[model samples]
Target: MEGTMSESSAPRFRVLMFPWLAHGHISPYLELSKRLSENNFHICFCSTEINLNFIKKSKTFDEISSIELVQLDLPDLPELPPQHHTTRNLPLHLKSTLERAFYMGKANFQNILSTLKPDLLIYDAPQSWISELAALNHIPSVLFIIVAAVNLSFFYHAVNCGIDGTNEAYPFPAIYYRDYETKKMIAMSQESKESLPEDAAFSPKCFELSSFVLVKSWREIEGKYIDHFSFSCGKKVLALNLLNVQDDDTKEEENNSHIMKFLNGKDESSVIYLSFGSEYYLSKEEREEIAHGLELSNANFIWVLRFPVGDSIALEEALPEGFLERVKERGIVVDGWAPQAKILEHPSTGGFLSHCGWGSVTESMYFGVPLLALPMFYDQFLQARLAEDIGVGIEILRGENGQTNREEVAKAIKMVALENEVGELLREKARELSNQMRGGGEGVLHEAIKKLKDLCSKNK
Candidate 1:
């Protein structure tokens, strides 16, 4: 079956996009789908129903009729139900179970392939079997890595050189993880290994099987790392140059007036926007330290707090006692969700107190908001370092034992947001990057689309 033909009688490449069951992964895939749909590609975006529902509700897709949503159903296990199919509010322990369930849905996904018979497949890196599945149907597959190129390069280096090898240090020294973080990463890696099947394909295998790789970054910020990653992987690594910025959702804007109102009242470059992304939950100690730090920073701020799926902890109870009353005048503590892009783009948003998630980092950079980085896990540490290395942010280094220090948090916030030399320099650099990133990416994106077309044409 030849895919859908455009009005001009040209065959529009039908591409199946399967991202891992995480908001971070799914969101970029959707954005990529939108981009491709505009350039004569029909996209079948496949994910669990729960995730697809969120995408369906997004206003970004309202006009993009070429992008179709396809649901990949996972078997409902006792602990893993339809509601828990996504990683949004999922507990850390159930993460492995979700992966297992995702893998178990292979047959269902295979059926989807049989029905769609797409020209190409673009899949997330975690589910390495996706490439194999696509190959089985003679479909070309590309690995879409949502993480930063620096992180991928670091991991590739570590894996190739052995993490414990003293003979070879990572090529980039600025992006090294702390001792405690290293320990945590090792433990998590071991846990993942024990939980998943022994034959499960990882990054190396995924790179091997893919026709090419798509990284969610641009050349300006990570040219060296992108080049390094390509050399390491021995595959054509194409930068999607997808910043994942969208027009503010009209529905969300109407509901989030209070947040904008709060920002309007603040002075320009005086408020810090605080959010730790959706997946990572803070411990009580971490929460209290941050609350106290916010109090100490004395900067006007909008802090968004989120809890796990089943947790019913109240806002007052979760924060430090008297913290709300103390900072009420200068700060607004939002529960659950907020319009992040809107807040970042606002004039009052001076610094982003972020977990250094790639999505958050890119958004922050796009808006020229300097970062007060507080990275928690995974590639976040590297992303935080990248922001600092690029002169766009400052990392709040933890204690030697890896404990969050309130004073350090406050110091970094003041340093990044306040009108000091350091803050001024960071903000200027951020604006410079924002200008570059905004004006750039068109050439890269066009080249990437051309490559996709070439790949699909060859398969045909």
Candidate 2:
């Protein structure tokens, strides 16, 4: 649906969307743009050329006529070339450099805003300067958070109280991090602090600058966390229901015959689909343990493996010896990418062995696939805990040092995928939640659209 003129035949409100330079961030922003466009809002979707090129290739991009892809060019740095502008397959060491490059594109972004003169700006956090720029142009800005509200609320709590030596405990008991994870979190925080400018505005300050905030989640699953975050930030938080559920069967059929064929041969509710998202890659030990665990579980499975850019390590080198031969009939290992949504929607896929990225968690829930959660890092641990807390998934606990063993992984797979009382209960709960989510988001989305329009009108 394309946006139409108002009853008075006035021009549709124009929104400029600026997401951070990561696939995860860009994807949610694109989905939100689609929603806004359908509500009679013209959207100027801005990103680096590489990222925009990627969006142009997507099947969904062809269907949206109301959105215009605008390119925001970063300064030409020899180390950070055009291809490296996006975070897809980015080298770990160059991450900070990429951020610096993104920050340097402020002048170019300002030019875009000036040329487009959008009535509103919808942007991601950590780019708090955007709200200020939008205000200078007499436009309202809304910060769109792509992660789970539970994860954001936890950070807000920690930052408000000190990370260490806090007198008050985090409000949610179920979402505490392990010792190793806590240490890693602190280290990451310090690293980010050092990399950016002293006055760089993070989430807390970004929340203050926005007219309102939007999270890519619904109240059905995260009401408490969303309420907590809204109260703490003093911003009206609107929830955008699960935004990435692709319904494009035509594209799936054209690209995924081999994978669909493999899944078609499997029994109903018998195959486990494993993936750790696009950005994260497993260590050698982690790969061996997961491979051995799949062997031990004796469950049919499909696992997607990814390697960092320019890394040429073969599958045999990455996995345990003879692992492929051992599971030839029962398993398929895809390198780089797969049709994740299609696989989850398949009747044969009963469980998802995942790193529990928020996107993956929502997709699994939408398809009523029980989660075999093995959260690896950052907000993933919190998302994994939320999945378990809701009784739609079970976590594969690691040691105090955050080491995963084959036994735990196998146990989690069997408990979630095999025919048993626990698995049955989880499946039922997943279906219930899916039903609630599918049935209830239209009202919330309409309410959010009204709020956005009100903001635009006030500024006009």
Q: Pick the TM-score winner.
A: 1
lDDT for each candidate structure: 0.86, 0.84
Off by over 4 Å in 2: 1-8, 199-201, 246-255
lDDT per residue, candidate 1, 262-351, as tens digits?
A: 989988888999999989999999999999998888888999899998885999999987888988899999888888988999998899
Candidate 2: Cα lDDT at 76: 80
Candidate 2 is scored at a TM of: 0.94
Residues 1-460 of candidate 2: C-alpha lDDT, one tens digit per residue: 1247553365589999888888888878878787777777898999999999889876567666699989999888888888889888887778777877888888888899999998888888475677878888888888888889997788778878876426688787887887888898878767777887643536576777788888999798999999998887888888889468544446546666788899899988889999998778898899999999999999999999999988848998889999999999999998877888889999988899999888899999988889999988778989999999998999997877889899999998888777578888998999999898888687777888888888888777
TM-score of each: 0.96, 0.94
User: How does residue 235 of candidate 2 score in lDDT?
Assistant: 85
TM-score of 1: 0.96
